[model samples]
Target: MDADLLKTFLAVIRQGSFVGAAEQVGRTQSAVSQQIQRLEGLVGGPLLVRTSRAIRLTVAGERFVEYAQRLVDLADEAKRAVHGLAVQRTLRVGIVEDLAGFALAEILRRLHDEAPSLQLEIHSASTRELLPLLGFRYDVVIGMKPLASRGGVELSRLSLCWLGEWQGGPVPLALHPDGCGMRQAAIQALDAAGIDWRAAIVADGILPNIAIVRAGLAVTVLADALCPADLPRSQGLPALQPLSLRLFAHEEADRQATETLGRIISETLGAAVC
Candidate 1:
């Protein structure tokens, strides 16, 4: 169908007069009338019945009007698609606090340059929390695989290790609450060796654990992917077998190529943390 005819018909309906629609569309009243006439002829039915005092749509007109509105909306969306291809509007991203050590800052920086208009909402939580929320909560999430979740798949995997202040005595350990994979791995290692240790502190967030470790408060086991640059490390093999944590991304409609995002994360981990 001719979009101009649809436009003219819609304008006439909205403005309530051909003369008014002509003005609204920047066309002569006769041109508007011609467009309407062409549209009525195509439909093979009367679209409108007009009187000097009033104008209104027929049953056919109302149905066609609905379709006309959809066509106009599609046209507008087509225009927006060009701009959207260049930059997404807002990307909702969520990651567990642990993975933030390596991948968090990297993806954020690349998104800034490649999609400047994108509004990133970063949510940090546990792997268990982050995984299921990917169904509706976020566009991307980087964290350990959730045990029961079948939604997201791994982007990459890295070894987990126990690191602490070398000078710190007997390595008073700080740990997050139980049920966490990291904590489970650490304790299993300690138990098998029959190692004696003291629990000096417990923190809810990974950042706090990092802070405590950096401040020499206590030692903690963390993913090798997260060794930060600012804190110096002692050169030695981890006491326990290294664990592996897989980074995952949300999978749903319109999942895009994540190479750029992956590279940013890998490079950032390389620079800021080992």
Candidate 2:
């Protein structure tokens, strides 16, 4: 039995929606749905029932939840027995919202399991903000930048695309508030191409931005990995350049814990990019 599948199931149960669970676990909603489908197949029955607004556990899921908890508890106990105990440390980690939505949960879980006493203070923001927060405010920051930019090891490079509905005339844009790398890429691409566009909905955070796009308010530039399947890529739009996610560390923090956490995050999200 895969512990990850169990955890994913529990996350869906707790979150009540795949989108919410994906954010909680740091996986795409599509990935979360696939995990649930895999778990149902393994269990030989449906575990979740999806309504228009929320997801509910089926009878099989309810029964399996208890076993899942016990299994995870036993696994944690076994790990603790082998590694002994962990020392107390407060870890301040700054992560770009894009990466956080893809693989934040598992990375944080790995760090906690590896060092039981590590208390995490997570700050999720756009790469533009997270980059500056590194060292001064955060122990480490996981951010996205143009592939051409030097500094930090590249974890993944993703192709960005315009996503949402096209209602004709002056492209309506649902953009991230000023400081986002994706926003800059979109603006630059449109300007370079001499395309006319307007910020129909200027929002902060991925969820709100996605909501605005889904409502057909405006189109936004997003990585193929993070974009939901239902949101069609807008046609006849200027091509946006690719971006690379990289890691930045502050030497002032605890080297061992920071390095370990960074390795876990990089390993978890390496495949999320194009």
User: What's the true lDDT of residue 200 in model 1?
Assistant: 68
lDDT of 2 by residue, 1-274 (tens): 8888888889888888898899998999999999989989999999999999788888988899999999888888888776754446777889888768866777778887887778878888887777777787898787888878889767778789899888668888888887677888999998998888998888778888888888888899888776677887898888888888787877787878877887777677666666
Q: Give the TM-score of candidate 2.
A: 0.61
Q: lDDT (CA) for every model shown?
A: 0.69, 0.83
The TM-score leader among the candidates is: 2
**lDDT of model number 2:** 0.83
TM-score, one value per model: 0.57, 0.61
Give candidate 1's total backbone clashes.
0
In the range 1-274, model 1's lDDT, one tens digit per residue, is 8777888999999999999999999999999888898999999998999988989999999888899889988887887998776666555667768666555665687757765665667788877677677758777766654344354443445556766665533557778776667777667776776665677678777888888888877778777766675665533424544433444555552344343455556555553331
- Candidate 1 global TM-score: 0.57
Off by over 4 Å in 2: 1-86, 113-117
Clashing pairs in 2: 26-102, 26-103
